[model samples]
Target: MKKLKKINFLAFALLVLTTLTSCKVGRFIVYNFADIKDYEKFPARKIETGPTKFHFSTTTKGKVPEELTVKDKKYPFEKYLADHKTVAFMIIQNDTIQYERYWQKYNEASIVPSFSMAKSITSILIGCAIDDKLIKSVNEPITNYIPELKKSGFDKVTIEHVLQMTSGIKFNEGYKNPFGDVATFYYGTNLRKAVSKMTLKVEPGKQFEYVSGNTQLLGMVLAKALKDKTVSSYLEEKIWKPLGMEFDASWSLDRKKDGMEKTFCCVNARARDFAKIGRLYLNKGKWEGKQIVSEDWVTQSTKIDTSNGSAWYYQYQWWLPTKTGDFMAKGILGQYIYVNPKKNLIIVRLGKSKDKVDWPELLANLGQTY
Candidate 1:
């Protein structure tokens, strides 16, 4: 009887665990990418899957640059990996595999979540729509496609404004507590409605505030703009395949069955593919003899714009590292894809997602050395 009761209790516990996790994950789908509205400004598009794995035992550990001497010689870069409880995968230049090491049991095969970093990729696809003339202009109101947002504070927001985090329309965005607006968006049900109903806290385009709502809004715009097509499809055709990514990638969708993609952050890819995006920028949007993203677009999107002259600012979706041309796509925790066009380098580091603030200085140290 004791044995039978123990087995039953264990079964019950496992069932409970599975239920809670599913509910937590499904919260995102219920709110943001729910299937109800129908709008398509651009022609229909679909997602194209990209490469995900290597054929051999390849590691980026070999590409440590010869010039990687840091300000402190006491800090052995090699030893840093063994000491810090973090995960990192690095690629230098577009084609070179260098210095990929992981801790906390993570490696290239780990399909880790991409926090907000996926927004960078989403913005790239938006730019493609603009280039293809599917989008009339960033200046054109997204409302021209999705009219539901017109009466809301979003009426005044432009695609350009949203891309740069300058959209003044209000959404509380820091992740401090479960009661906060941003936190509620993540944890609460009906995330799309909750976000859409959020009142604009400030005037549009006058200030800089980071909000996941901005990216979510961008996804809604993209969904409406690309009629009958998945953003994934468009991205694969334009960015993924053209860049020669090495493995298949996955986008965590809001609703898996209905194909609602998590526009803000849903990408899962290998470190090499992340490096390819960086390399794409390093090469100024050219890949494999094709001009995927325009050099002019890369320049204008990454150039410092509002709020800061030195600490670096965002342009389009890319973060300017300095007044120089170096740019980065950073996500929650320590996810980074750093690109320097002048140096002909692209570096990627994917790690545990909840420890970014604890190690910004350390990350900066690595960034500077690269």
Candidate 2:
């Protein structure tokens, strides 16, 4: 009887250890676990907007091609959507909704997570600050605005470097690693304190590296520069209201109500509303003939940076394809806002899968055939 009791105790201890380990892993991939059913329900802080809403004119003439070629393999677009676990797919052309579809009970009212696409929005906010003359220039050192970062090894880091993602901060962006900086930042309570712990490992602007820490630092700089306003208010006043976003969006904060936004990720809004952002860029920072973001800033923001080499394939917080006049704002788990100015096209895809899709090629095909 004593031997049986001892074996049971050992089994219970093993079970406890396994449970503890799983909890850690759960915290690490907290952002990765969302699916169509629960994606719209993720926790976030409200970024309230004004009453106006941008309405898109619809057309029945446009249709998506049934199939597309990826890596020389003929794949059906329907199958692709199913395989990728896509929740929403939308295409807008000439300022009209050509096609829009929702799956898994997701509809027009659903608030989808933008994930890293928030990086591009944060970049736009930086441009707005520059436009308002609140920020002198992108060339100015980040420490100029956030003086507390003076000793944080950002002596040579500029706002432009951070916007271009070449800040040289030693950060691990691997989403699979439970102990990495990204996981900690996503799950931690205090964003500023978490990012403040980062240290420099290389000279700023030496090479292009994609790290979430750069955007987080930019968020801090914007907060300090604005003084009286929060980033959310600035976004609402400058971009959201100006563009007439249909639904009020929310940006997830690190803490309940007072903490800073996780600017590297987590802007939640309807998929159709996201299309408006694409249209704003498509029109060269002009919405309804009004220059919302400066045309010069738009041109500069999307221009490719070849200082290091052609290998980086990055612009100011935007991803460029081999083709010119086209750019993309991407996020983890298959969120994309692909804009082709020449074609007057904007495609937005939101999904729960992490599978890699050739966005440029897909856009090229759609532009040619659809």
Candidate 3:
């Protein structure tokens, strides 16, 4: 009887292993959850820094608050951040580094995955594409580039529809589900094939439904528009090289060879370099008198507009946490690139997880103190 039981147990274990290995389940089982260091797990294309690096002027006597009140209880600012799984936090104002801190052994050189924050970066590229005339306009039907998706009822979908998150495309945004669309995009090796099979969940240009797939579709459209240039290469030429980034970053791809960038997420970069993205927008798309991206695009991206299926709080992939004209690029697990134009402030916080803090609110309040 004991021998028979052992044989049955072994059989079950083998069956489970086989099941996991044959699908995205195995990837999920191995990866488990997203982490800041997840850049190491995926294939990527490099974004090289420019010859000249722009540095934020730092102050010796930092003016950032040392104590923060959460839930009506006061706690040390560094302790609050450290206890809440924070890895890096930086505050920049007037092109100056006011306060910077790192915890959990993460430092200036550590590479952190951007997660959904890449969505905002993707939006920037879309704007750049328009400036380059590679893309005509946001009003153009996405089918102009991706004619294959026209059969999927994408003809009704405009580039602006996807940009505004009103595309109504069918996508499972939940990353934890192994069988979901996000998991397939994240773990599966073929993004273009998956994108080709995309379908609409509802009529386009009606309601806002934020999904990573919308950004991925934009990536596909951008790819089609570029013709010969990869999106990463365009980024290197347009933004990365011009921004004067301190470190060479990378955009994770779905595969190593003939790979499509996972443009919905996975821009792996350092904290200081990420803050430069905010600086670019803060200066209205100008870098040292050079208009990197159009000022009109910057205004359209950050302005509060609620017309034609646009969300009042979100425009072009940025989150307007309040009606204060501030916007941010947010990611899962507490990663943020917050820009406050009124205060000339930019705050970057990268972390292992959110840890239940009202981050947008905290950043807003912290900005008020400045």
Candidate 4:
């Protein structure tokens, strides 16, 4: 009877494993949490880099301090980053590399998933689409491109509303809940279907609510605007290639075949290329005398604005940490591309987890020293 009980337990365990692997929420349960390495788990479309590469001027004696203090306690700088699960960190100022470091066996070439930083990139793409005339304007109702959402009363929602995360879409942003809306979008194989079923929780343009759904909706709109071109290809053509990224990166998709990009997150790239994104915005969307995106769009994205229920700290998918013209592209797992145009500075940090650090504040403080 003891042996039979053991066999039954084994069978039950197998069943649980099967269940966890088969369903959408179960995939969330299996993965447990998001990670910098998450790109490995998903299928992706490559954002191919151009033959012309842009390299930051490097120096052996970078000005970064070797130690940092927190809550009146001091720790070695590298130790602090490692303790915080950081894998890659870089500092750039005056168009030169100030400091670059790696931990956890990660290096310059290691790919780190951008997490929500992709939101900022999505915002850039939207701006580019507008500039290219593929998109009429942000004021236009998103229903112009995605009319299917009209059935859900999304006709009143503007692209600007989604860009500001004030769309009032009924979305659960909690990552801890396996059955939540974000989990379904993050782990489910059908992003288009998931987005199509989205309904409004409240009227759009009423309040500021930070949710990933808004960005995904923007992705859908972009897909429709681009028509035959995939969003990834558009990104490659417009940003990646023009930026002269040193390495090829990819945007993770929801499935392996004709899959929609998980544009609410998941841009997998190296530290340098990620830094270039910051550089782009730092120069007001210009790259090497070429206008990659309009300076007006960059101003609109990073400037302080609180109108129409929009939060002052966020606009056009970029976080304005302070009113001093500083902005950042932040990800869930401690990933960041912090840009301070006032100081001509950019800091890139990628980690397995945030480790409870107020990174924007830290990076901003670091900027003051430069």
Candidate 5:
């Protein structure tokens, strides 16, 4: 029986390797985990975006070891790490890398799209804009700067309201069959133009309405405040490098003109470097000795506000789960930077999930096991 079990294990391992290498799924490569460094992959930082000439961290510091089993799961997390569509999965606890694994397809150099997760990343950048004195306050009416907004209902909306998804913009959260305003705005017309033309259906900040329209509106505000500089440039100067992130992340554009980077979604990054972002939040926007995010921003941004039966709520584009001592930067279809400061944990899970897959339970369960 022991001999038979060993044979089956070996055969399964071989099958996995063969499938990953042979499977051709769009831009993804499955079987190149061992030789990940050799896959001719896309650049982590696109030069057109003005990133400070790409810096590669040749030596991975505090590298997480491979093959940690997920306790009490139908399928082990290690198997998910090995075969899931995700390019990378990293878990750090006690400020040490506990588990780090890359798929056969992706490596340190390849970039994974953040999708809707980009909104949370933009939230931090907006914090930086405030810290740098480019923006006076989150409460300032957005129309104060953009005269065109004065005639519309958005004139009453503040940056804080936008960030918290409580802007109360009349929007439907439906995405599956996206004939609605938010969907048409995102998937149909030019994003910036679509948002600029939005007519308010309700008062601002009355209730939470998971609308991307507000974030896109805020993106236009960032463009105005940054002196017409590019999103990538401001991010590079303020947030990206200061965080000690080793790779360059790309942002999706609002239009073919490409200068207006979409804030509600579409930022791509490496798995480990994305973990660095979780670590940055873990350390409260500080890297090494200096403070990158003001203590106030981190405190206020993660605070639970507008509760929904104590499940979770949005604050400054960050998600606050009901469990105290835990806040996360989560994106649609399961891109997470789950940080538990109390437990000294930072986790990154990047993937391509065509269908919904529950991961919060996966991490919450880890809290008990580890």
Candidate 6:
């Protein structure tokens, strides 16, 4: 009788857990269980590229330092990658591929989700829109582009405010909560509706809050400003095609066919190709002697803003390093594109989960050595 009762108790607990896992909040986890396990298969919208592919020069010089020291301690590079569940680790120096390695079947051709790194890409698109004169300036009221948001408490918001994540939009960025705004943005359909429902919690540009909704709002503004052109097309023509990315990347959409992209996250591309974005910024928005994005825009976008007071200084959509001048585009689950202009180096790291390695410190240490 005792043994039977114990078995029944165990079964009951599992049944309750399963039921909880199937709820709306839990649905994202259950539905994407397979995708979470296999990142390469994450669904996304195709961002097609043109025929010409940019070729990266290869060199054997400057191998990754066997180990990187952090906080006065040394850790092996290979161990760091393995421990962090790194899928791809790449280093580029002087416009040459210095070191490249792949793990768990991911290689030069494999595409991985960029998570929030797309935020930086979206900011670049905004700069392009400004350069094209589609929008007057970053200071222009975002409502000038998206009139629909005018009455949504976004009347005072500007393009610069959204890029700086100072839109003061009241949004819960918690990923763990199933019913939170972030989960709705990430797993729920209908991004347009999701963003439209957000209300302003404070005055725009008063305080810096890193909210994905800010980027989503910016996307809506871009869509309005571009009119007939899609964000993907603008990116393709202005940056991707010109940069010569080898593979056609994709952005995950809220729905199939015509749904809006989750502009705050989800740019799926190869590690090698993602490195080009860093190199583009490192070269001050010029690609192969052509001014792809204006030098002034790149300067403003990557320049660190100390006013935010965040541990990682916030710039236009990029994260400024603790050290000055060098910057990085970071995403959830250990995705990073670290650029050091002084060293003429770019490091791309993509992983399945948060890595144990402190990349900023590692980069700072590398900055000292290389």
Q: For each candidate, give its TM-score against the true structure.
A: 0.80, 0.88, 0.93, 0.94, 0.77, 0.89
lDDT on C-alpha atoms for all candidate structures: 0.64, 0.79, 0.91, 0.92, 0.65, 0.81
- Clash-forming residue pairs, model 3: none
Residues 1-370 of candidate 5: C-alpha lDDT, one tens digit per residue: 9999999999998887666433223113342211223112222224132333323223356543333344443664566555556656777776566666667566666767776667877887788888988889898887755657667777788887777776666666565533565454443435556666676776776677777887887787787788867766777776667655667666655334444666777677777767776777878878677887787888887776554212146777777654576777766656788888877887787765522455665665554445
Q: Return the top candidate by lDDT.
A: 4
Model 5: how far is 71 from its true place, Å? Answer: 12
> Can you tell me which runs of candidate 3 are displaced by over 4 Å?
1-23
For model 5, give the 10-residue run with minimal summed lDDT: 31-40
lDDT of 2 by residue, 1-370 (tens): 9999999999998887655434435544544543433324334666766787779998878666678777878888877776767888888888888888888787888888888888889888988898999999988998887766678778689998888887889999887787778876776667777767888888887888899998899899899889989888888898888888888888877666477878888888889888888888988999888988899888877776577422245777887764566887888777888888888889988887656776656765666555
RMSD of each: 6.5, 4.4, 3.3, 2.6, 11.6, 5.0
Strongest candidate by TM-score: 4
Off by over 4 Å in 1: 1-73, 184-191, 307-312, 353-370
For residues 1-370, what per-residue lDDT tens digits would candidate 4 score against the true structure?
Answer: 9999999999999999888866787888788789766898888999899999999999887887778767667789888988888999998999989889999888999999999999999999999999999999999899998889999999999999999999989999998998899988899989889988999989989899999999999999999999999999999999999999999999998889999999999999999999999999999999999999999999999989999999999999999877788999999988999999889999999998889998888877777666
Clashing residue pairs, backbone N/CA/C < 3 A, model 6: 25-178, 54-244
Cα lDDT tens digits for candidate 3, 94-195? 888989999989899999999999999999999999999999999999999999998888999999999999998999988779889999888888898899
* Candidate 3, residue 296: how far the Cα is off, in Å: 0.9
lDDT, residue 294, candidate 3 = 96
Tens digit per residue, CA lDDT, model 1, 88-122: 66756436565666676666665555566788898
TM-score of 3: 0.93
